[model samples]
Target: MKYEVVIGLEIHLELQTCSKLFCSCSTTFGKEPNTNCCPICLGLPGSLPAFNRRAIELAVTAALVLNSNVQLKSRFDRKNYFYPDLPKAYQISQYDQPLAKGGYLRIETDGNYRNIKLERVHLEEEAGKLIHSGESIIGSDYSLVDYNRAGIPLLEIVTAPDITCGREARLFLEDLRSILLYSGASDCRMEEGSLRCDANISLRPSGSDKLGTKAEVKNMNSFRSVELALNFEARRQAEILVAGGTITQETRHWDEEKKLTIPLRSKEGSSDYRYFPEPDLLPLILEDNLIKEISAALPELPAARRERLKEQFGLDSSEAALFTVNRSLGDFFEEAAGKYSDYKNLAKWVQGDLLYYLRESGKTVEEVDPQQFIELLALLDAGEINRPVAKDLLNEMILKGTSPQIMVQKKGLGRISGDEQLLPLVEKVIDENPGAVENYRQGKDKAIAFLVGRVLARSGGRADPGEVNQILKEKISRG
Candidate 1:
């Protein structure tokens, strides 16, 4: 019997705040170990918690963007735990009263849109990082803890078990990351620990309403890893069920090298944390005006921007999706499109050659000057340069940050449009390939393309392709 995979994700996104949630310690990454710590964040005795206003605003903004209902009153509770990374032995988090709840993000899978419902979005303090001497904590002879990440504000987004497979989970995360980036809530950089996902996967009988035993999988540092780990976990659980073995509720660690999930320990429920309201802090009460103000001030999100790109610039869905994958890329297109009226050509070049060169040269869109790109397109549109020459100049411009006009002038890369200059090369190509000339003479018109290619190749990609094609056909027809 086939089994269905039920996957839910708990995403921990670090807020884009300069200071820790309750302390003034720097929230910057890549700092010296233990350097960005303070008494409040380190949980030393007599250090009381103080909430950061910016952190609250950001969290609320994120909730609004995700369509979550922000709570009027939310309180903090101490989540009791014992680990070296937890200096206070308890992490201050939300319990029954969270900041927001009941939100959904839409993801397109196989041409169908799925609404992945969310359980809650809560504000919490981040735990410190653990550095083990061995490959993992399982075999480490010694360990070290860095308190710098401690007390950093985190927004924990818990999704309902609405995902059906690994690909859907990845799609949801990609759309979610785009939304967060557009909202300026977090950088969503999985590499820097700004965004992290822990997946809970279980396998249930096909068409069963009841859920199966889930194992929490951790250590997924990228989107691809999340998809792979969940797929692996689903297969592992299914194998046990097929063999009539019982599935256990446990927490597993994803071994990247092994490409499998390893059983870590038994999973804990809500009671394991022993949560209790903290007496040091008061309950948060959001005013109506503040919520309205934040809602009104939200910039154009990804969805809205996508629609506008399609309507305003007449971009197709695929083209709009390509440009709006990231806000920066869409902004670059819009900026260049403003200077050039040919939206179709602008979109094609940006999506095709610009993206290709950016990936090939290890450069980013930000390094490219939009005006310079527009200049290149203008040169091509005006027949000053052919497509091949323009592509080469684009690659060079990306690598050297040079202007297209200057590159053309300095390197004599302009199009060879003059028939007088191109005739010798054309005659040479026809004489060298008598077969092509004979084929064209015998009414095989496609042979002219081969002869035209030869002519352009002789001109170092500077020859205007349209002019070469016309000139070749005229010469072949006369003979």
Candidate 2:
């Protein structure tokens, strides 16, 4: 019997606040171990927690972006647990009264869009990092705890089991990350551990509403890892069910080296945490005007931006989606398009050549001047320089941060478009390749392309290709 894979994700995002969630300790990463700790963050005696106002504003902004219903009065609760990374013995998190709920994120899958329902988006404090001596934590002889990441503000976004496959799970996260970055909430860097995902996956009989026993998989650091882990877990569970075996309800760790899931321990439920309302902090009461202010302050989200890019700039869906993923790149395209009349060419250069060099040179759009870029495109449009010359000049511009006109003048890379200079080169090409000239005269239209390439090569890529083609055809027809 065929089975259906059901997956849900609990994504944790570290907020971009300057301080910790409940303390004034620095939230900076990569400091000396435990250097950023304080009494409040360390949970020392006689210390009390105070919430950060900036964290709250950013959390509310995330909720609004996801279309979540913000709770007017939300309170924190103590999640009782014992772990080496948890210096406080219990975590202060939201239980029944989360900050936001009942939201959705729409993702495109298989050429159609589907809304992945969100269960909640809550705020909590991050746990410290555990540095193990060995490669695997399971076989580590010793471990060290770093409190630098402790008390960092975290936003937990829990989604319902709306995802049907592994690819869909990956796409959902991609779109979600774009939204988070666009909102300036978090950097969502997987390598830095700023954005993490825990997937709960199960396999049930096709067309059945009853949920199967799920195994929560952790340690997936990247989107590709998440998709691969979910796929492996789904297949593993399905194999067990088909063989008349039962799947154990446990927590599993994704072994990246092994490329499989290993059983860690039994899964825990809400009762296991022994949650209760915290008495130290007061219930949060968000005002109406504050919500309105946040809603108004929100910039254009990814979906709306995608649509606008397509309609306003005449970009196809894929091209628009590509540009809109990075706000700066999209802004660069718009700025250059405003200066140049050809939107399509501007979009092509920004998305194609600009992105390529930026990645190769480890630079950003901020480092380059948009007006100078438009000037370069204008030069190409006006036939002042050919495409090859423009590309070389663009690389230099990206490296040295110089203007296109200055670079062109310094290198003497002007286009040889004058018919007086091109006709002789065209004649040389026609005389050198007698066979091609004969083929062109015998009605083979493609032979002229070979002659044009010869002329361009003789000019050292400085000749205008259109002019070469025109001259080559005129010379060939006259003979």
Candidate 3:
């Protein structure tokens, strides 16, 4: 019997705030361990918690963007747990009364769009970071905890079990990151621990509505790992069911290096947390006017902007998707499009050569100048420079941060189109490769291409390829 994979994602986003959620401690990353701690964050005695208004505004803004219905009143509860990383024996988070609920995000995969419903978007505080002496906590002889990240305002976005496969999960995450980045809520940097994800996956018999026993997978750092982990877990569960064995519902870790999942511990239910209302803090109340202001301030999200880009610029699906995810590249392309009418050519260069050079030179889109790139394209179109020269000039423009036109003028890297300069090179190529010339005379149409390549090579890629093609054909036909 075939199996169907069911996946639900729980993502944690660290809000971009200057201070901690309920304390005055610094929220800056890369600080010395234990240096950013304070009485409120360290949970020392005689300390009371205070809410951060900026954190609320940012979270509400994100909720509104995701189409969630922000509640008028939400309260915090104590989530009782004991771990070295969690200085506060209990974490202050939302339980039954969350900030918002009932939203949907549409994702596109293979040219088909589907809406992934959200379960809830609640606010909470982050736990501390654990440093192991070895590769991981399992094999390490000792572990250390740093409370610098503790008390930072965190948003937990939980999704309903709507995903069917690993690839879909990855696509949803990519689109979700783009939307969150556009909302200005979080940086969504996975490497920095600003954004993190844990997936609950299960496999059931095909065409059955009853869900199977799930194993929550953690330690997946990258989007690609998310895909691999979920797919691997699904197969593991399926193999168990196919045999006379049962899959144990437990928590697992994605060992990125081994590229497999390892059982961590038995999974915990909500009852295990022993949640209770916190007496210190009052219930969060948002006036209607504030919600209206936030809703009006919402900017264009990724999905709408992607469709608009396609319609406005006549870009195909893949090109539009590329621009939507890489907002800086889209901005550069749009600004250059204002000064240049060749939309197709501009898209090609931005998506193809520009991206390639950026990866090779360890440069970002911010370092590229829109005017310089357009000038390079314009030079190529006007026949002032050949393709090879234009590519080299583009590389220089990115690396040296100089204008392509200035570089061309300084280096005398103009097209060699004059017959006086090209004829001698072409004649030399003909004399050197007599076999190719003889083949051409014998009516071998492809032989002329080799002769042209020799002439272009002799000119150090500065020769006008079009002019060489014309001159070579004329010379060979006459001979």
The per-prediction tally of clashing pairs is 0, 0, 0
What residue runs in model 3 are displaced by over 4 Å at the alpha carbon? 427-447, 472-479
The lDDT leader among the candidates is: 1
lDDT of 1 by residue, 1-479 (tens): 88999999999999999999999999999999999998999899999999999999999999999999999999999999999999999999999999998899988887787789999999999999999999999999999999999999999999999998888899999999999998989999999999999998888889999999889999998999999999999888988999999899999999999999998999878798999999999999999899999999999988888899999999999989877885778889999988999999899999999999999999989999999999999999988898988999999999999999999999998888777898888888988999989998888988888888899899998887888998888877776
Q: Across residues 120-234, which tens digit of lDDT does each residue of candidate 2 receive?
A: 9999999999999997789999999998998999999999998988889999999999999989899898999999999999888999999999999999989999999999999
The deviation in Å at residue 356 for candidate 1 is 1.1
Better of 1 and 3 by TM-score: 3
Q: What C-alpha lDDT values do all the predictions have?
A: 0.93, 0.91, 0.92
C-alpha positional error of residue 65 in candidate 2 after TM-score superposition, expressed in Å? 1.6
lDDT of 1 at 61: 95
TM-score (C-alpha) between model 3 and the true structure: 0.94
Clash list (residue pairs), candidate 2: none
Query: How far out, in Å, is residue 106 in model 1?
Result: 1.7
**Most accurate candidate by TM-score:** 3
Better of 2 and 3 by TM-score: 3
